[model samples]
Target: MDWGLVGILLLMGAGGGFAAGLLGIGGGMVLVPFITMIFTAKGFPPQVVVHMAIATSLATIMFTSLSSVRAHHKHGAVQWRIVALLAPGIVVGSWIGPWIGKQMNTSALSLLFAAFVTFSALQMILNKKPAPGRELPGTPGMFAAGGVIGVVAGLVGAGGGFISVPFMTWCNVRIHQAVATSAALGFPIALSGTLSNIYFGWSEPGLPQYSLGFIYTPALAVIVAASVTMAPLGARTAHKMDVVSLKRAFAVVLFGLAAYMFYHAFA
Candidate 1:
């Protein structure tokens, strides 16, 4: 549609994708809140824009996660066994979480999202010197963790890396591998969340033009293009730099964003 809008979308995707790889975040943590602001500025109905932004963000994350996961897999950083064990729970939880989220007020959702962002930032800052080795959670336990992560993912339109990495680390998986596995898990979270967004928005009318259910096509196009291309670069950067330093920097950024979001929601 509009070339200018397309450009913005691409930049958003690239930036979000790069951050996802570099910071071990799902990218949604950055993308959703920002996209919501964009939609708000465009004069979309405030009540609906937040949901649309989050849903579109999840859709874009689906692609970014693939790129990030592949890069991690190549480096032997992904834990396939864990991904397999957790996917079922993630899929089911992701599907249900959005349904519940759709019923909540816009301000409440934004506040919840802000809290999650702050928590993620704190976790990154605190998780310096990870624990020892990998511990395989049996089927039941893995599913439990996945379900929790999935529900959150659905509500926030996130990759769940914010929660997944720590959970994996707590289970004794190495930090790098935990981030990688979390990246892979994002794919399922995005897929289920996207579907749920569509379901939730299917009957509603009078949305902004160029939207497909809850996803705004223009934004999705931009985000997917930029993020997919640059995510690998972030993965590469992770290899070159000191992880603790990067994590600290990432935490600062998250804190700033969280503060901005809190203001946006309340003010």
Candidate 2:
């Protein structure tokens, strides 16, 4: 292992996990872009770099979600009912996401990732609220929403919070509950996306050593270790801090990340 890369991954995990806690994003929104930069700078091939970055970033969510949810649950912030209603669709949609990714080339995947990140940034910056009397839909509608969330999240390596939080809040869920619930939802997203990406990329060539399909194991291990340590702290901070300014600052950072991904798409 390159010790230097490991140190950087550690820092990435610390930042990603905190973001996951603060933003309920499962760290993927932060991890994907940074991992791509790391891999790209090392001269990795585009196919392996983009796919592995997404896969490894997603794999870390399994641990971060658990840590984050524990903190949220301690505060009675998780909405379990909604999690149950959304899960079946999420699993099915997540299973298909990596297959769709497999069919796309490096450029297309990069562009898609960029678009998703840009949308997320804009959504954060806008911070719109839903109309009064707007409520969560019926079971069928929840499933449909879950399907869309799962597919997009799996494709982009997010925890689905970018979409799910606003959605839950729009339906009149409390912000704290929405964040907690989104953290809980991360487990399912991570499990299905990680498995599917592994399966889809299993036979691909040119992957580096210490890799499991698309996941770079060293990065995954270090990131998970570091992220898990920070997620709970982030969760605690969420309940105690007023983060409006922080959110805007983070949104600005996301725009920069999106720009990098866009440049990468055509590079």
| Per-residue accuracy of model 2 over 1-267 as CA lDDT, tens digit each | 689989999999999999998889888878998999998888777776888899899889989999999999999999999999998888877777877888888878889998988888887788765543578899999999999888988888989998898889888998889989999999998899999998988889888877888888888998998999999999999999887778888999999998988888898
What TM-scores do the predictions have?
Answer: 0.93, 0.97
lDDT of 2: 0.88
What is candidate 1's lDDT per residue for 1-267, written digit by digit as tens?
Answer: 578767776777887898877766778888887788788888887877778888998898789888887888888998898899999999999998888888987788888888988988887788654464557678998898899999999998888887788778877887788888888899999999899888888776778888888889877877787899998888778666767877778788889888877887786
On a 0 to 100 scale, what is the lDDT of residue 219 in model 1? 78
- Please, what's the RMSD in Å of model 1? 1.8
